[model samples]
Target: MSGSFSTPTLSTEKTFTFYSQEQGNAYAQARPDYHPTLYQTIIDHHLDSNGQLETILDVGCGPGNVVRALSSHFNYAIGLDPSEGMLTTARSLGGTTSASGLIRYEVSTAEDLGTTLPQPILDESVDLITAANAAHWFDMSLFWASAARVLKPGGSVALWTSGRNRIHSSVPNAAAMQSALDEIEERHLRPFFEPGNLLTRSRYVDLPLPWALEQPIPEFDESAFFRKDWDVAEDFFAFQPEVNMDVFEKITSTASPVTRWREAHPDAVGTEKDVVRMLRRVIERHLHEAGVEKGKEKVKGAIHGVILIVKKKI
Candidate 1:
């Protein structure tokens, strides 16, 4: 799985900077929590018979979801993130001290962990490292090397993510919903999914972390994990009626393409309300075609991911 490749650089622009304390708190409330069995499975496979796990590190601990879930299992846990707002939300969500008074939070990036934390967590000191949804933003080479430096021999690293299943059976118009997905793919996702694009190109490559670790990464084991699929009625309506209106308005205002359009017209900002009004009309029409009724049905789908009990070569 080795290859010559250039990693895609993420934009540091503060576009998503608004995912601050308020946003994080909202996300914690709205986002689904992971199943407890998932964590147990990872522990079962990765930990020894004594069932002891100490010194866990959670990278990208958004609102401390993973930390809160797994903290009880470890003697000491640290949640690290670059976003102060997110850290604040995490702290608010019971991400404080461990039972043994060993838990802590650090503000740092994945690559700078050693420098940022007071007592540098040494090479082969950590027992487990987990990154959820945030691994995609990391510099793989640096992350892998750093992770290896901080982890003990035979330590584990887990990467996980979940996405909305928009094509569930609970929705009223399944065919129309699929059509919408097709349209989104055709109009939005196609450009990114094209050959040579970042997503497509990196799908097959061994990620930077594994290569950097200088160890043979184990094959992903899915049987040790649990997966579930469900319907999301609330998400459907919120997107169709509530937040989508505001989101569309803001995106048109802030995004480069639409901002460029506004620049060309000069009078566009004055008519912004009308623009939102018209956009709503278009969305409403599409929803009608898709047989979407307010509060009628909810979005549904399956969610699945692996929980690997990774171990570094001794």
Candidate 2:
């Protein structure tokens, strides 16, 4: 008999999808891009394992960044997200393939795959599927089932997300600075974090694999599953080594918990009392205490990133 367990239900998948168009645009602008090495690693693995580059589907593709980045390598690329607001921003920053192929941006949740589209994605047509910083919100059971339905025999799935943000080692009193940052999350943001957030926080260690399901999907090769991690010291996620408090404020505000906090305290949205604003001021004081001059507090930040790739057996 097989035991049964469900992946943690991420609220954002249903009740908390992006509330407005403006919010989605802010997210695209504020978040950092993944390092080239991260993409290169996925590309190399796909090609090495005889995966085709004809078509790629990026699920949970907020603002279309991952699909946009990978479009140049494939003839056809489509990005799907449950949030129409996010898909709106994604289309605005349009991308094309190496052969100048257009990228399709669709408003469909990962669980639905592209089956609901007017031109529904044909079964066994996708060559590669990717989810970047967005997989944590997926219903993995539906995700893997639909993924297996759409992927070609030799296709692969690549999923990646960052762990908690960390103060770069070079920052003065970095240990204390790190502690200060942790305190903000502990005292304030903790209340707003949804269950899915923990998946990313833990670097997806507990994210279920196809074979881990109660009724395993036979298409994926359990033997071909792979995982890789990059520490905070690694230059693999955000390219910038440091960001001043203002930029830090912007980045932090893009987080889901911050958004939720703002929702709960709408009156404080733009003021000093804003959760992220107050957090930034605390960091500023930390910098001053560490002897960093005003307007020169360029603290380093690094995101611990992890990627998992699994191939479909031919």
Candidate 3:
């Protein structure tokens, strides 16, 4: 999913600057969408007695995926991200349903709450705030301060990361295929992952939170805030369908490390012998040896997610 290189490994700092318009397009086009049921679960867990939510804010809403998926539950929804490129792609691609209320996107960082948000998003006004596959990049100190400022008395905050150890295939040669994917990560991508990514690599257990410490941040008073891991059942249904080889390759290309690799070695991408194409050739050969064919046999996998939810006092 990336160009091959025999030179020294590229620095992970590239990732922080990787969200170009083209990169944003590729990410929006290839990344898997989250499950609607996951949004429903968050809603059911926080709905008031009347089962209504007035406003929702999604922080670090890459391409506005979570907002697009969960907007239906609230009277109004807003998605905020620092990446203007991502917001551009999101506005062009996001959709709405009758069940959903008005949705908007903002080019704002999570730490810049008041300056970037509308007055209606005042202190203690938002019912729910979520960050999916994004909290790892946040300055938790600033984020917690902003989250506390905007959340309503009984509001909820949910953070989650998916696509970690998550994909499992049902193909006959699933084990071999899984191994191939693992090798791609271990050999080609893992080294480029940033320290903040430890939260994702550890399946969210290492995610930073104000309430996780023995002395919780004053903003998240221990008596007022409560936390729990969202139970993603071992047998949770697959979030994505069985995809053909081309689609799988596209998905892999959307990965940050792969994108960074391409950026660092632009001269090598999209060529006949590009690293991504080479990787694809190897994986395809493995599949063929196992009786799978390109464009014919579909590869399926289960996506795993780890979520943590915290509720503020009313």
Which stretches of model 2 miss by more than 4 angstroms? 1-16
Query: RMSD of each candidate?
Result: 6.8, 2.3, 6.1
lDDT of 3 by residue, 1-314 (tens): 01121111112224633377776788877876766666666777777422248878898787877888778767788888777778788888775633554578876767665455565467887888998877767666567777888887778888877736433555656677667767866776667666555556666665556675334555554543334343334432325576776887788777666676776778878874455666666566767887876657565555556667777765
Q: Tens digit of lDDT per residue, candidate 1, span 91-138?
A: 776753346554577777776655557776677778878876556556
- As for candidate 3, its clashing pairs are 4-275, 166-304, 168-301
Better of 1 and 3 by TM-score: 3
Q: What is the C-alpha lDDT of each candidate?
A: 0.54, 0.83, 0.66
TM-score against native, each model? 0.67, 0.94, 0.82
lDDT of 1: 0.54
Ten-residue stretch with the least lDDT total in model 2? 1-10
Question: Can you rank all candidates by lDDT, best first?
Answer: 2, 3, 1
lDDT top scorer: 2
Scored by TM-score, the top model is 2
Candidate 1: list runs displaced more than 4 Å. Answer: 1-5, 8-18, 48-52, 96-102, 185-206, 209-293
